[model samples]
Target: MSRRTFSVVVLDSLLSLATKLQSGPMPEPRVRTAGATRGRLWRILMVAGVLAALGGAALVVTVLIRTPEGSAGRPETAAGLPGPPIPPAGTDAVEPSAVPTTRPVPTLTLPSSVATSASSRPPTTSPSAGRGSSTPESAVVPLTARYTTSSVTAGLLGYHLDVTITNPAPRAHTDWRLVVTLPRSTLSVSGVSGATATQDGAAWTFTPDDTTSRVAPRASVTVSFNVNGATLLNAAPTDCQIDNTPCTT
Candidate 1:
C-alpha cells in the first residue's frame, strides 16, 4: 500500500484501541473490588504492549521499503523516499557531451584558369641533356667577311684593304681562318695585323691569333693589309672564305 494509506490505517487502529480502553464494558460488580482492579490494570498494560509492538514493526517496514538496496546509510533526499544516484567526478563516468576529435580537412579549390595553367605547363629538362660535341642542326655557323679598300695616301701602296669578319652564330667560334684569293698580278702585301698570314699562289690565308682566336656570338674581327700593286678601284678579294664556308664580298 502507499505510505500515506498505510500510515492512516495504523493510526486508525491505535485510535480505536484507545477509545475501547477509555470506555470499556462496565465490569461486573463483584465482592472483591481489589481483584477486579488488578485484572483491569493488567488488561490495560497488555493492550499498551501490543500497540507498542505494532508501532515498532510498522517503523521497521517503512524504513526497509524506503531505503534502496546496497545503500548503507548514505545521505538521503526526502522526495517522499530516497534513491536517485549522481555520478561522481572521475574518468570512469560517461561523458554527457564531447567534441569529435577527427574530421576531414577542408579542401581548397583553385580557379579554373589557375588549374589549367598549372596542368598545361611543360616540365623542365636539363640543358646538357641530349647534347654533346656535335652542334645541333639549328646552330650552324654563319661566318662572313666584308672587304673594303681605301686608296693609300702614300704612292708606295696601291690599296689599304680591311677584312672585317662577322660571327652570327649563337656561340663563340674557338678556331677560325680567312682565306683571300687576291687579284692576279697583285704586288707583295704588307701591314697585316690581327692574324698570322700565309700565301699560296694568289691566295692569302689569315689564321687568327690568340687575341682574335675566339669570335664571340654576333661579334666581328678585322684584319687589314696593304697591297702595293695595280687593282680595280672597287676590287674585292676573290675565293674569300672563313673556315670552309665561302664568304662572298
Candidate 2:
C-alpha cells in the first residue's frame, strides 16, 4: 500500500480497538466499576503500545525497500536534490580562472635639449613649370641630375661632361631629355654623346638615343657630351636639367 494508505490503516485499527474496549464495559456499583474500569484502561494502553510498535516497524521496512542500495547515508540539498560531490580528504581544491591584466603603453625617449613641433614642408617643384610633362604632379618622378667634367682638350678647350640622370622611382622611365645652357661667349659647340643632340640658340637639348632610351628603376645613367669653347679654367655649365630636374655640380 502507499505510505498514506498504510498510515491510515494503522490509525483505523487503533481507533477500532479503542471503540471495542469502551463498548464492552457498562455501569456498575462505584467500587466494582472502579476496578473493572482500571483493568479495561490498562488493556487498552497495552494494545495501543503493541500496535504503535508494529506500525513503526512497517514504516521502516517500506523506506529501506524504496531507497537505493548505497544512497542511504548521502546528504540531500534543501530542495531534496543531490548536491555536487565534495573532494576527498587530502585532495587539492580547484583554482579559479585567471583575469587578464592590461599592458601599459610604451615610453618614447627623445633628446631633451631639442623642442619638437609640426612645421610645413617647403613645396617641391612640379614638372610642368620646368619644361616637363603635363602629367599630374603626383605621377611625376622626382628625378635629379648632376654633372662633372670628365675631360678637357688643350687647344679647343673642349669639355666632356658626364651628366648623371638619377631615376628615383622603382620602374623604368623612357623618352628622357637633358637640356643644357652654355655661356653665350662660347666659340664653337661640339657634338653630344650617349643621347641625340639638338640646339635652340644657346640652349643644347639632348634626347635619349636608342641605347640610352630607358632609365632603369632606382638607377643612375651617365650621358656624356662634348662641348667646345669651354675653357679649362672656367668651364661652368648653366641651367643643366634632365626631365626638368635641375643638375647639381
Candidate 3:
C-alpha cells in the first residue's frame, strides 16, 4: 500500500483507541476482573507494537522509492538515469580532418646561353664525297662558297675590297685555297688574315694559314684590304677553287 494510505490507517486506529480509552468510565475497581484487565492491557500493547512496526516499514519504503539507485545523493540526469561514458582527453574517437591535396607548381625558365647555342645551331649532315655515276641524281655539290662585294671609297684613290668565303660542304676541308683573278693589273694587294695571301701581278691566291686548323663545314671567314693607286675594276673573284674541286660562288 502507498505510504500515505498506510499512514492514514495507522493514525485512524490510534485515534479510535485513544477515544475509547478516554470515553469509557474508569473500570470499577471492585467489578473489574483480573483476566479482563490482563486481556485489555495485552490488546493495547499489541496494537501499539503493530502500529510502530508498520510506520517504520512505511518510512523505509518511501525513502527507497524516492531515492534513485546509485545516485548516492547526487543530482540525477534528465531521464533520472546515469550518463554514457565519455572518451579520454587524447582518445582517437575524434579523427583529424583530411588535409586538402595540393597540385605541384609548374616552372617556366628560359634556356641558358650554352643551351641556346647548342639547340639554336643547325644540324649537320654527312657529305657524299667521290664522284660516282651510280650516285643518286639528287646528290648536291660537296663544297660551295657565297660571294658578296662591298666597296668603301678612299677619295680619288681606289676602294676597299672585302671578300667573304663560306664553306657549305658537309665535311671539313683540311687543305683549301681560294684563287681570284683581277681584270686590271694596276691595283696593289695586301696579305689576308685567317689565310696567307699571295699575288702574282693581277692574280691573287689565298691559302689556309699554317697556324689554323681545318675549315669547319658551314663556316665563313672574311678577308678585306684597301686597294689604292688604281680604280678597282671587276671586284668579283673568278675561278675560285676549294680543296681540289671548283666551287660555285
Candidate 4:
C-alpha cells in the first residue's frame, strides 16, 4: 500500500470512533430526571389522600353529634327524673250532698219614744204678769205650749221619751219653764183646786217655781223625760209648739 493512503485510513478510523462515543446513552442524567418526575407525582397523590381522609372524618363526627336519645318521651317528676303515677278515678270526687248548708237568723226590735214636751200659760200674756198689767216689749213672754208623741206603742205600759228643744233667737236662753198637760183620757190629777186656766180649756198646766230651765243660741237640748206609761199611752199628742208658735215635731 502507498504511505499516504494508509495515513488517510487511520485518520478516518479515529473520527468514526469519536462520533460513536458522543451518540452513546448517559445513564446518570436520565435516571436523575425520571426519579424527580416520579417524586413530584407521589407528593401530589399524598396531598389528595390526606384531604379526602379529613373530609370523611368530619362528616362522621357531624352525624354522631346530630343523633338524639330514644328515651326522651317519658314523663318527668318534680325531682327532674322519670316517674309513673296513676291518677284518681271519677268515683273519688265529692257529691253535692256532702257539702254543708247555712241558715239566716232573724233580729228583734222593741218600742221606743220619739219626742215629748210641756208648757203652761195664756196664749198672749207672760205667766209672770197679772191679767191687767202692762208688759214691756222686751220682757220674755210665757204662752200656751204643746208637745207631740212619736214611736210609741199602741198599748205599751212604760216607755222612754227623747225631747229635743232648739233655740232660734240670737241670744242665749238662760231659763225655760214648761208645763205639760196630759189628756183627761190618759192621766188623772189628785189635787183639787180652783186654778187659772185659758179659754181653750182642753189642757192644764202645773208650774213649779223652784227649778229654772235655759237654752243656748243656735244650739239644741236633748233630754230624757219620764212620765207615767199609762197616761202617755192613752193621751198621745199630735202637735208640738214653743211659746204658741209651731216647733219641730
Q: Please tell me which model should have the higher lDDT, number 1 or number 4.
A: 1
Worst 10 residues of 1 by lDDT: 229-238
lDDT score for candidate 1 against the true structure: 0.74
Q: Which stretches of candidate 3 lie over 4 Å from their true place?
A: 1-141, 210-213, 232-239, 243-249
Q: Give Cα-based local distance difference scores for all models.
A: 0.74, 0.71, 0.61, 0.46
Q: TM-score of model 1 relative to the true fold?
A: 0.41
The C-alpha TM-scores of every prediction are 0.41, 0.42, 0.36, 0.28
Q: TM-score for model 4?
A: 0.28
Q: So what's the TM-score on candidate 2? A: 0.42
Which segments of candidate 2 are over 4 A away from where they belong? 1-138, 152-156, 185-187, 230-234
Better of 3 and 4 by lDDT: 3
* Candidate 3 lDDT, 1-249, residue by residue in tens: 545544456556666765676576645334356867776776677668756765776676677667654657565566667796678888768667898799889987766987899999999965566744444544543544444444556234655555566656555656667676665567666635666778887777777676433656667666555555555445445555554556454
* 81-151 per-residue lDDT for model 2 (tens digits): 77787889999989788886978889887654443332234567755556544545357576788888756
lDDT of 1 by residue, 1-249 (tens): 545545556666766776676578645445566877777777777677867866776786677568654666555666678576667777376656877899889999999999999999999965576665456646667788777777755444477878888887778876777888876645557889888888787888898898888889889999888876665452446567777777655
Candidate 4 ranges beyond 4 A from true positions: 1-154, 185-212, 229-234
Clash number by candidate, in order: 0, 0, 0, 3
How displaced is residue 146 in candidate 3, in Å? Answer: 2.6
Instruction: Give the distance in Å from residue 106's predicted Cα in candidate 4 to where it truly belongs.
Output: 97
Number of the predicted model whose lDDT against the real structure is largest: 1
Q: For model 3, what is the C-alpha lDDT against the true structure?
A: 0.61
RMSD of 2: 20.5
